[model samples]
Target: MSEDEHETEDLQVEVAGLLLDHVHAPLLEDQHVRGVLPAPSEAPAVRVALGDRGECAPSRLTAYEIPLGAGEELRTSHDVVALLRAVHTGTHIYLSSRVTSVMGMDLYLVDPAHVKEAPFTTDDWASTLLRCLAHPSEERPGARLRGFLFREGGLLRLYMDSDEVPGVIAADVRPGGALTALLAALPSLLGEEWRTSDAVDDPHCRSLVDLTDW
Candidate 1:
């Protein structure tokens, strides 16, 4: 082949590889979204602080912390997995987002036993969450697990709608918290970076899932 043709072919291959990498990158590896992951055994206990409210731009937000025992830290991904396992043992787990419209929000529900059966890894849990967040109608009924994860100002928010006592529980991502660990582990979990944007017109925002559901 001609030198110029060979060079063109090489360029095409390089471009293809780059595209593949981008397509496979994790959805939450962005520095702004990344969270810390701590060792589960040494992690601090996280208490569920109720009635904690804050403001994020145009709306007032309320956070309902999830209670944790010693060596149970929401700041670590491992603890998060444990929490999910514990909660799912006998009840339904629903993930939901903040109500942005008068029509209300859709709740994503997942099978607890299915999640529990997954390998005890951060990536496994993250994958479970991503699967839950996928387009509900497009997904099977068993995958319609409900929950919400999004960014509000400087805080990363997670909301759980379950059949438990708290009913609707919320967790704000702290430094090195489970939220961060989940986001950090997402890329590895999905084999690609998942991209999201704050712009309302963005595809993520306009679609069934958006930055609000991150």
Candidate 2:
């Protein structure tokens, strides 16, 4: 899809909100959408506060500035994965405009990468589970997926049992692919760098990982 087509303001706000709720960090006094950007400039964005994660450093805090918008900003699962992969203490992203729409929810959500997987959103983890459990047949009905979603520490995680698989499957919210595994891999991915560096390690850096529900 073109950049213009990918801008989903509601989804962006929802994603930012997920990060705020689940990312393990100390929220600064100014971490809200309005708080992050004072009056006049106030726009839609997720201001995240994160704990430092260097294995050998003293305690410190970090905040991530993630901007939500359309085509001009982080537009793909790959972009998000790379952003998470590269952040140090935290990262900054800015969507050029604000979300002013007040539209109702859509009947279907299609992931750019996986048409078979339909992801839904709610205010938080508890509600997400309530949705999955509310129906024995799953909200999707005959769809082939029985997945429950939740957000925790920068990750939107999905724990599911599929009719096609004998064991449980743990997934992050994403288009189906290897990118889904990046969150759990952050520790080791950072570790490889830690092992070779002489600088005092930041534990936060070593442990930071985000998620999504499939």
The best candidate by lDDT is 2
Predicted candidate 1 versus true structure: per-residue lDDT over 114-213, tens digit per residue: 3443234434444444443443333233222345444445443344332321233343332232544454443223222133223343222222212333
Please report how far candidate 2 places residue 150 from its true position, in Å: 18
Q: State the TM-score for model 2.
A: 0.29
- Over 4 Å off, model 2: 1-8, 17-44, 52-59, 69-78, 89-140, 143-175, 178-214
What do the candidate models score in CA lDDT, each in turn?
Answer: 0.31, 0.33
lDDT of 2: 0.33
The model with the greatest TM-score is 2
Task: Report the poorest 10 consecutive residues by lDDT, candidate 1.
Answer: 30-39
